[model samples]
Target: MRVYDVEGFPNPARVRIALAEKGAVDDVQFVSVDVMNGEHRSAEYVSKNPDASVPLLELDDGTYLSQCTAITEYIDGTYSGASLCGQSPKERAIIHMMNRRAENGLLDAVGDYFHHATPGLGPTLETNQVADWGKLRKSKAIETMRYLDDTLKSRTYVAGDTFSMADITVFAGLAFADFAKIEIPAELTHLSAWRKKVAARPSINA
Candidate 1:
């Protein structure tokens, strides 16, 4: 399998981290996508992913997969070394729920704010359409962070005691926010500590 990746990007980093957690980093081929030069918008890339996003996975059988969440789940399900998703139905549901909360509540909001509020990049992003909504979205993201910080005060990871897919999603989302100049609030002590833990992992730098 081959992974089309981009450095300094959140989505690709998520997959890379998952691969690292599963100890499958060296198993797959890596191809860099030059987002700086608008390579993802080219005809060749468009053919692979009509949405023109990075972090696309190409299977040996010629099947292509997009979206970081879906790609990471595929990797975790296929690899047996470490179970990043979960082992039981209840665990799976909890992890999925937390992952969705992080993605929809924080990650998507951060992306919207970055694309609409920040200058440069996001040329095709609907700046006008999201201009008014950017502030609201950013606020929502902060609220989610506060909730996560509070909930995580007594837990080690997002989904409970184990580091699961929910942790991966939250880590990636927060990492993305870092590049956008968004800083975690000082009150979110639990989340701040969790961020350091995830960052210290070897896979995160991969």
Candidate 2:
């Protein structure tokens, strides 16, 4: 399999961590995408992924998969490791629910704020930005942080006990928030504590 992404970018980091957790990091070939140079927008790149997003997975037989959720699901299913999705129906529903919340409320919110409100990736890539929309999303991101902090006060991980894809999403979200200069409030001790534990994980630490 070939995974196309830019290292250290928030979304790409999610896939790398997932791959590491599955012990499949070395199994896949990584192709770098130069977003800053507009390589992702090139016709050659868009042919494989219309979304023009990074962290894309290409199966050996010529299948292309984009989006972190879909790519992570493929990795979790194909590789032998603790399930990142879930085993039972209930677990699946809960994990997926939490994952969506983390993506929309935190990750994407921070991304919107960065790209729209701030000078994200500079004027070349961040054209057509809406400051008001970005500001609104920034507020939503902060609200989600508070919610996650409260949620973590009880559970050990984002989606209950085991560290699942939801946890990866939230971890990447917080990392992006930091890069975007959106502060996670100091009062959110539970979130901070949870982040510390996740950071120490072998997958993330790698």
Candidate 3:
């Protein structure tokens, strides 16, 4: 299998971290997609993913898979050893819920700030019209983080005690936020501690 990725991006980092956790890093080939140069929008890349997204997985049989969550889930299911997802149905549901929350609340918000506010990769992104929308989305994202910080006070991980996909999603999202100069509020002590724990993981730097 081949994985098209971008360095220094959270979406691709998620997949790389997942591969490390699953001990499947050596199993697949990686093709770097340079986001900084607007390479993702090139005609060659557009043919592979019409939406022009990275972290796309192409199977040996020529099947293409898109989206970080779907691709990561497929990896976890197909490898089947040290599972990053929950073993039980209830656990899986909780993990999925937390993952969705992280994506919608944190990741999407960070994307808004990057694509709409910042002049990402120069002319590749439109920074003129979406500035206000980006600010609004950023405020919403921070509010969601505050709520998540409160929820995390009682639980060791996002979903429960185990290190599942939710934890990975949240960690990756928060890391992206950090890169964008967004800091976790001081009031979110639990979240800060959790972030530290995730950061200390060896695979996170992978």
Candidate 4:
């Protein structure tokens, strides 16, 4: 399988962490896509991913998969290792719920703030920016940080006790926040501690 992604991007980081956690990082080939140069918008690349997003997975049989959650699902289901999604139906549902929450509430919000409020990649790719909307989303991201901090105060991980995809999603989100220069509020001590712990993971270091 060939995974088309850019290094240091949050979504691709999520996929890499998933692959590492599943022990399948060495099983797939990594292809770097120069998204900053508008390579993703090119007709050839758009033919594979209509959304023009990175972290696209192409199977050996020529099937293409986009979206981080879907790609992680394929990896977790196909790869033989410890499960990242969860083992039981309840755990799976909760993990999915928290994963989406982290994605929408934090990661996507931080991305919106970066692209709309601030000059994201560059003027070429970040066309039609709305500073006011981006500012609002930035506030939303900070608010979500508080929510997550509170959530983490009671549990060791995002969904429950185990280290699941929800933790990975939030970790990637915070990494994106850091790249965008969005500082985590000083009052979010739990979130800060959690960030430090997650950052030490070998998957994240990879």
- Residue-wise lDDT of candidate 4 within 1-206, one digit each (tens)? 99999988999999999999888899999999999889999999999999899899999999999999999999999988778899999999999999999999899999999999887888889999999998998898999999999999999999988898999999999989999999999999999998899889888877
Shift in Å, residue 72, candidate 4? 0.4
Identify the superior model by lDDT, candidate 2 or candidate 4: 2
Per-prediction count of colliding residue pairs? 0, 0, 0, 0
Give Cα-based local distance difference scores for all models.
0.85, 0.96, 0.84, 0.93
Q: Give me the runs in candidate 2 sitting further than 4 Å from their true place.
A: none
- Tell me each candidate's TM-score: 0.93, 0.99, 0.93, 0.97
lDDT of 4: 0.93
- Candidate 1 per-residue lDDT, tens place, 19-60, comes to 988889899999999877788989999999987998999999
Candidate 4 lDDT score at position 114: 96
Off by over 4 Å in 1: 120-129
Residue 30 C-alpha lDDT in model 2: 90
- TM-score-sorted candidate list, best first: 2, 4, 3, 1
1 against 2, candidate with superior TM-score: 2
**lDDT of each residue in 1-206, candidate 3, tens digit only:** 99999877888888888888888889999999887777888999989998798889999889889988888888999886666777899988888888898988898888888778777446645536588887887887798789888988899888888787778888888888888777888888888889889888878876
Q: What TM-score should be assigned to candidate 3?
A: 0.93
